[model samples]
Target: MFIREITHWFARRSFQNRIFLLILFTSTIVMLAITWYLTDITKERLHYQVGQRALIQAMQISAMPELVEAVEAHDLPRIKALIDPMRSFSDATYITVGNEKGQRLYHVNPNEIGKYMEGGDSDDALYNAKSYVSVRKGSLGSSLRGKSPIQDSTGKVIGIVSVGYTLEQLESWLNLQISSLLFPMALLLLVLLYCARRFSLHIKKQMLNMEPQQLSQLLIQQSVLFESVFEGLIAIDSQHRITAINQTARRLLNLSQPESELIGYAIHHIVLPEAFFYDAPQKNKKDEIVTFNQMKVIASRMAVIIDNQPQGWVISFRNKDDINTLSLQLSQVRQYADNLRAVQHEHRNLISTIAGLLFLKRYDNALALIQQQSESHQKVLDFISHNFRDHHLAGLLIGKYYRAKELGLELIFDPSSFVEHLPSSLSHNEWISIVGNLLDNAYNTTLLNREGSRQIECLINSEGNEVIIEVADQGCGIDENIRQHIFERGVTTHNNGDHGIGLWLVHSYVKQANGDIIVDNNNPFGTIFTLYIPFTREE
Candidate 1:
């Protein structure tokens, strides 16, 4: 089964699965974003904490009376001893005592025994802190500093005592805070994850318990909405095995026993000519009526494609008759479409001509020609188009010829002298109407006769005082049960989308000409329709 099958099988679900999915999506994103935010915030807080502790430690070291006296009296060894006990980080190489003027009072290293530390410069970190507070990256990006003013026995401030350390202390402090924070965040994440899994399982169960018929109904409803769809719908497994075939699929694929156990049969095995999957969305494919096994069918497939894998498909079918009628009607409508397109093309040319005339300042000639030749002429053309004799046979074949070609069915009509000369013996419009309807019906039947090869034969021969027009096809002939009723207004053997108008119209129009029409299944495998009209006897 595929994702679509899972969805379709449980279409009437309570949306539990979707809700769990939403929760999982939102929770994960929130967790990651918040973790990043808190981590950065904690790192900054830990950095500041390290700085504050260094200040306190420096104050304590500087408060030593011996160290303070050492700074004032410029005692180097005393200052080094006082700083040594306080120093911990090895990166803090040496310690120095500097005065209020940033002049070095004492240095643990002999090279700085009497060096004057520049007040604003960083030659001495602790001395600079007395006047200005800062953390600066040194020769090796590290600095922790503080300044403490020293006093003499008279309690007068004279020099500043300072100490310096490297940044390892700050790293230790940050890591401690980070390690402490991890435990709680991990707990929160685990709890949410546990909740998500539980919710997902519950939702999945609810979705699994849902019904599929509801989804099927919705699909049928959608079918009732669109027009001119050509694909034969085949709902099948990825192996092309049939599951549920629709009416269109039945006709297209010879799914005669619709209720039979067609569930596991390969679709290619069912229909003579196979239909293939199209890239259009499972729901958005063009619905065309195609012939299979010489039967007319509207076939389309709803393949369950997930992760680019085909699992199954939903095959839907409607009768070929509906499609045939629709195709015919669509062709009929095209008559007006061409005329409209022609008018637009003519209008464009007229506009261009008018623009050119105006540019040449032939204003009077342009206006008069526009009114008399363009606008007035357009109205006359429109009237002629409205009353134009559109193809008399346009409605007859319903363009079923193209469909016949697709099914490899042979459909031929005798384009004899009578086709063009029928007007001489019959009413021109009536001839168009009758010949077109009969031929169209022939083409349809020939395409659908799945039992054997199909062909059409037409012979318009004059016998005695009247002319004869016969339209015939070698097809799976009409059933004996429906033969008598074939000429009735609503008694059609096959019902898909047709209003059962073809034979009925043929009967009516032939009767109006005092002509007789008959259908005979003389062949072992197909049907033949013969039409006879009285010759217009010249008085």
Candidate 2:
């Protein structure tokens, strides 16, 4: 339990602190171990070297004939004179001359000259007449000692000569060796710690100083959010490779492979319309509307920047169904508002007329005029409500009636125009555009004529999933030169600063509905436009 606690405590430390501690601990252990090992080895080697010199010194003293004769005569003073000078000159810690009976004859300490010698190497040198070297403890502490036997001319042993050096001398030399190594080892430890600190700092910067567990949690959250979004999103790297693609993006792109394998592949290989991603990232990002997989979608792009440098890009898109639905709602609201404004203007004019008649004291005439106007407006409303059961179509025709009357022009629905049912395939907006633009164009052209003839006629009929519409205006007929391309974009007879997209939009809608449109410019009075739109509803 205690060991585990220590490990846990160390793991919780900051990266730099942990690294420093580890490096220092390891380096200290290694250098100390090496120093201890080398110190012991040097001590043993020095002891052996000093022992060799001691043996040589003992041999030189034993070779003197004067020392052998003096030992044979039991002359202590002569022996001491012979050995004392050798001890001082050879730097030996102790020198002793002893007889073969194990009794000391001469010593550095003169009081022990007659003492009995005690030690295994001393016995081997004196009695057995052999020379040897060994380590032993004496009165002056531990020492490396070398011993040799002195003999007469017949090779008989007389006495022994022993030379010794204390272990304290070896210890002093070992201290000097350690002193030389300490500085270099300290420098090496400092270098190791510095390198470890630098390495830890680099890793911290790369990871933004966040814990590993925190980074893992953040990645999991981002992944969940990416897949949960309804809109499609994709990320591209600087090399134009697809780095990431969400589920919605894969589905929109019509990809069959797994997202993992799709990464690192060039985006151009996946998206068929390669022009969509040709432009690099710019400061001002814009939303682009494009067609993908036969579906209309709005795409938006943004650059991923770091330190004011471009790294990659992220693109997101949403399908156009939502935008179109909102646009339809807004157009309906605007149409209703226009209808109300026209009605308001007409009512104001009527109120003024009635006020003028009353102010002139013509009460009977004002009442009659109000009744007549009421009856006329009711008749027009009743006719529209009765003929068209579809509220949208009826509302549009009624609104146009007021608009036409306001312009001093007469607008009428043909008696033969009958639609018992409206199909679902033709949307309300499409119907409004087709009928509304045609009527508007007719009204504008008829109003241009000052020949005292300003009139328009509208016919609407449906038969077996097909809708037929015909609008005619008593204005100057279309010119033959521009009639061929009249339904094309940027083609208009008005010659005003307009985009001339009304007829083009009409033609485009008819084509999208698989319908047809024809122009009858051969009319003696004005021009006529007829449209046929077909739709199918499954049973």
How many residue pairs collide in each prediction?
31, 0
Q: Model 1: per-residue lDDT, tens digit, 1-539?
A: 69889777555444565565567668878978887787789877755665565555556665688876777766667777666665645234334566656667665556665676433344343333343234654332456655565656765556665445556766676678777878887898788878987887765554454434555676677655322345455566767777654554454554567535776887667766674443343443323334467665545555676667667766556665664466556755763454455446656677899999999999998898788865655553343333333445432332433334444554454544133234353444446546656666766666676665567665554434555667677556788888887876666656576857767756765765577876777466656667777667662
Runs in model 1 lying further than 4 Å from the true structure: 1-25, 88-95, 103-133, 153-157, 208-539
What range of 10 consecutive residues in model 1 has the weakest lDDT sum? 394-403
**For every model shown, what is its TM-score relative to the native structure?**
0.32, 0.48
Enumerate residue pairs that collide in model 2: none
After TM-score superposition, the amount by which residue 282's alpha carbon in candidate 2 deviates from its true location, in angstroms, is: 13
The Cα RMSD in angstroms, rounded to one decimal, for candidate 2 relative to the true structure is 13.4
Best by TM-score: 2
For each candidate, the alpha-carbon lDDT, in order, equals 0.59, 0.81
